[model samples]
Target chain A: MCLAVPGKIISIDATDPLMRTGKVNFGGIVKEINLAYVPEAEVGNYVIVHVGFAISIVDEDEANRVFEYLREMDELAELEDETSS
Target chain B: MARQITIEPVTRAEGHGKVTIFLDDDGYVRDAQFHVTQIRGFEKFCEGRPFYEMPSLMARICGICPVSHLVASAKACDQLMAVQIPETAEYLRRVMNLAQLIQSHALSFFHLASPDFLLGLDSDPATRNIFGLMQSHPNIARDGIMLRKFGQQIIELLGGKRIHPGWIVPGGVSEPLSVDKRDTILAMLPEAMAAIQRTLDWFKRTFDQYPEEIRTFANFPSLFMGLTNDKGELVHYEGRLRFVDATGKIVADQIEAEDYQKYIGEAVEPYSFLKFPYYKPMGYPEGIYRVGPLARLNLINFVGTPLADAEWAEFRELGRGAVLSSFHYHCARLIEILNGIERIEHILNKSDILDKNVRAYADPNRLEGVGISEAPRGTLIHHYRINEDGIITYANLIIATGHNNLAMNRGVLQVAKHFVKGDQLQEGMLNRVEAVIRAYDPCLSCSTHAVGQMPLHVELVNRDGRVVDELTR
Candidate 1:
């Protein structure tokens, strides 16, 4: 019954720590989400939101590192093929 | 002319469902089909969403078993990240999942299916409900409420909310368990144990009252599938997949979640929205296997808990091989509740349960991932494929109810053939038909991923498709 959506933070109202709120973009839809749980979340960061609250901030660097490693492995495979040939 | 009797919006279960029983001209039952009328494309719409959001997003599927969706979805996400979560996080997740099982099973056995057991399946329709159960068996009613609350309170204390707790993240839970929360859950265990034990005793004493029901309510041979620990003991959170034949012989063991597609196959029927999952070796219709409480109890060697192990020993004696009757699903649920309470207490006592290292940080390390766990009803599976950007490209979920689709249809026909007579629609007969569906506690909402009410409506029509008689409650 409870629905959670992921969105990018557009603005943050951190004036009140208890009532920290942020405008988030869920695809084309936008809504204000409670950011009290994720105090370190900043504008432009993606957050996993549930019942109007942002429960976790998406790890962008850690997310990108996975693909970076994949790219490096692909490059290494290409070099290995050339050397073997 | 041949006639079709349709039960629209099957009552006392989650979501919207209907049953169509075809009768020959002389009023003999010919066939029956259980149709899940509503559909929500959770898999289709999930495309392009980041993989990390999946656990919470999928939790929207059903209120009753949101934690199941959360655990399965999170496990899939964990595969994408390719990181082993902290030991404490695993224990914490296990606790929440068991709590979810206890509450959901209580809802099925006590709240939804108890009316028939308590008031007699032939009782007055007007008062045949949870309220009716409350009025007639107040202590049983109170126990149900209190037991359900005990489980939900644990979920709330852990996840921050009872229904859709977002605390269970991809790598691990977002927050670690506090000493306070741990002690609170421990305090609730004794009462929860007593309540489940009382209910179990009552159920055993009353079990023999319905010999006819025990024989006809989907009582037949079928393959059973569930997750089990390395020792082949009962498990709910994480374990290898095992499949056993009706005779309780292991057909497949130590099957990993990633290899599910190789062993299990999904087939679709136009009659129902829910997809039928079966063992690939046996193929469709022939590969029919049951999951959930009955299967779990049948496949496990022991429950590994003092109280539940005792009950499990007695339960296994119910059948030479596997308990064939779906009627015992109610009994299996009570035993599970007892085990869940014991298991939760055991985990809470772990030294590392309060450790702060609950979650691990990682990037997507794999393109495809699969998560499998035992939900309240049965085995739940969530599969996802994400692009390099970690956006989901494909998603598929085999809900517990969907696994029993073929068997549920067979069960409806079994009950209909036994009880339905003449052109008249007897309340007791129809209730029996609905009761068979309840035996499995089919969560139609989770199966179809649709939202709706629980009240029932039935329509009897001739082969010409015109309604001749109708019943609603």
Candidate 2:
């Protein structure tokens, strides 16, 4: 099982519909994720990924809410360091 | 009748591949070649990316065993940062790796190679798929799905999804396992073990049916390479590389991941996009060796678990030296599935697995980092060079399929020479050629990571290169 984890899409490369990919930031780590599955997803939107493909999109508030929980847990140090204030 | 036969667009694999058989004037097989026929520029495309993104980015290489790439890349990033990951993180990662082994081995055994074994290699192509297996042996098919599903559930429980979960990151995992996740895996242990055991028992009982395959299927002496724990036991995620010669003698032991270049060199063939990784001392072609399940089983003396250790003993008794027949890769795979269950259970029972302090964060302290691990297929090495800005300057990946390319070519040639007759062109005979490649369970998708689909087309040509026969499954 590889498709797990939610990351915010920082940028989208829609040059090719079949090969639509985007840069997603998972906390501090950034990866090129396929956005073909979630065609409506855009930059700043959060998507759940499997393999290289984004399977589903989550609301901005929900994605932020999880980060808020992590911050509360004191497990967001990596993000606190890398993410913009 | 043609003097040469080619099988293109071979079916039942992740991506593209093809096989060519050269026949003499007598219509007998003379030479054979397995062509990957795909290209992936991962090295070139991945340059300039931040070192931290290595794990998540490289995980995109193969959907089947992305965890292998994830963990290995994370280790390389850890090396770059010179950080010591939390103990719990290592344990969680090891469990995930074993889960990956279970799911992937199940896929290879049940979905890919079983139809040939169970339905008979000569079985009709249309009825020789998972559906056919379901029609005849529903229990086996069901068990296979459950077994694969169990592996997937474990992954989902630990990371989140099945394909390329971003939970495993640089330094360590993104978070620790919960009490529920740990308990859920533990509860399913018995069922998982039983399913694998049934398949193993069935395979052993039916071993007598394919004696010809057992003998001629890539049965030769080259070398076996795999990772082993310090005490020389079966290791997947982390261990030193060990090389054992054909006769089961250790050629090189405890080779460091950082020193991989000194022992192994990558050679390129114009026919294949995948690099032929060979032992440096022996030189190209001559230094050909095999990796993956069969090689791992041959290289390790102990499995270090209860159920799998028993199976390991039996597997060893089959061959006095190395189990040269690639057919036993099936047996090795089943044993690994059992080993994986036991190993995962072992980790689950460990104390302090739920500790919150899993990641070890730091800045890049080194310019070069090499991460090595045993993927479900075989040994996978990820080497990277990062500049001062922590962006990747160079990236090289030696996938397990690439490592076995040399042996795979040899295996195809050997099987083709023995079984293929141009005038005959029997379906069973042709299937055997593809079966040989399947035995290695080569992941063209993972190895090439290139573009486009490869339809396996097997073509037969006359002395003047005129094609007369072709087979595509």
Candidate 3:
């Protein structure tokens, strides 16, 4: 079964990566997740959590770049609408 | 003395399962059984609940591929309401379903199965896992994470959350796709495309390395079943039922979802909680067939997308008939992911994707309804009988994993016979047995509607039922 959720890490509770635990915000809700699988994840970083473990850290830049592209597309659509009108 | 080998709570799969192998005195495997150990009784508990709540309720069956349950359950409720869903709603549902497939398949291939592929099946058990994969091949692992994220992000954009999103409802979706969400999903497509293509190339190159595995991992003649469009192209969200034999000949086609029970029969086994679904005409056990990626690829004529179609062309060449080996299920998953990405992009570009007319409101007109769709694993059928008050009286779910029960059992025996030896229990031999089951990528939780962890323990017992040896992980 492939159920996992992306959450932003709010705080780290442990120092050792293998024993690392953190509170992650899933949209508005937050829960403590194990960060052993994502050693590089830190406070303010987004991680993909599955069954209580952080499986991977999300690439914030890559995510933002997609939104930036979407914004540009919105601008282009507006220009096309204005020209047609 | 004759002995029995039991592998309990099979690891790396979605839910609790175990394998029991009976070995003759000399240590040769005589027979094997794949057992589903947990049961949730979702159907029984669903009674007395409002029919409209079925989608969200059914979505709780499994965390993985909840969208498939949502789609199938919603479709059943639509039939109960007797209203045709809007075109945009259907397209939106299709996009979400495909997104589910991509994410689920990625989890199967990358997180669960890749470690076995990258680190040889005989590799160190302690290191043979996703973490091991991340340490050894970070790039491949990253691609898998990204690909899965791409799917989850789309789902979150559309359904409002990554798992069990309640956006899909009876008759239609809760909301229409917004311009920003549509464009955002489109923007993510290029990266997802590259990730799948790269993984596909790597898998194709690595495929030939496992000749022996290809020959024995559920490599036998049986029927393959899945959903197909009118043109016989690949379809996942919605389509007519199709069954093809091992030789790739159409045994049954265009079967209505409502008529599924007439063609398929559910048989119970004393050994497992999962039901054995077989072709009705052929009868129980003998009507053995497989569903999921392998069966889907076998049943379809083409994948529809350019990149996936090219890979599918090569996949079909693996077998003269229906590609009997279950080992290739991994390869089939990669191609499907590619197809899902392309299909999602195509659906988003449709003019009506952002249309406001997406929901169809209607009261219950039908007391009995059947909904069928292709889940990430295989064909998922949700049937319900409701009262005049719109309360469900009965519900039956024949999950994709349940359909492959017989094949998975036979596959376990096949792998066991080939690799398992007398009293001595080698880790590799047992790993192969589990590998064969993993090839099916079964969600035992989905099949039985059960809940549990993925932990495995195996035991070897002598004829007197005495425990001779054991392995636990």
Chain B TM-score of candidate 3 stands at 0.94
Residue A12, model 2: Cα distance from true site in angstroms = 30
Assess the local accuracy of residue B305 in candidate 1 as a C-alpha lDDT between 0 and 100: 91
Model 1 CA lDDT for position B436: 85
Give the alpha carbon lDDT tens digit for every residue of B1-473 in model 3: 11233332321223466677777777777777887764434466578889998887566434446789999999999999999999999999999999889987887788778888898888866567665777789889889878877877888899884345789999899999999999999999999999999998888999778998889888999999999988899998778999999999999999998999999999988987688999999998899999998899999888888988988888888999889999999999999999999999899998878999989999999999999999989999999999999999999999898999999999988887887677767778777877888888776432111111133455665665666666554
Which is the better candidate, 2 or 3, if ranked by DockQ? 3
Model 3 residue pairs with clashes: A2-B64, B27-B422
Provide fnat values for all models in the order shown.
0.02, 0.00, 0.07
| Full candidate order by TM-score, most accurate first | 3, 2, 1
Candidate 1 global TM-score: 0.81
Each model's backbone clash number: 0, 31, 2
Worst 10 residues of 2 chain A by lDDT: A69-78
Task: Assess the local accuracy of residue A45 in candidate 2 as a C-alpha lDDT between 0 and 100.
Answer: 87
Off by over 4 Å in 2: A1-85, B1-14, B445-455, B461-468
Model 3, clash count? 2
Residues A8-78, model 3: lDDT tens digits: 78999776443467887755656666565456678998665444456456456533432343344346545
Docking class of 2: incorrect
lDDT-better candidate, 1 vs 2:
1
| Docking quality category of candidate 3 according to DockQ thresholds | incorrect
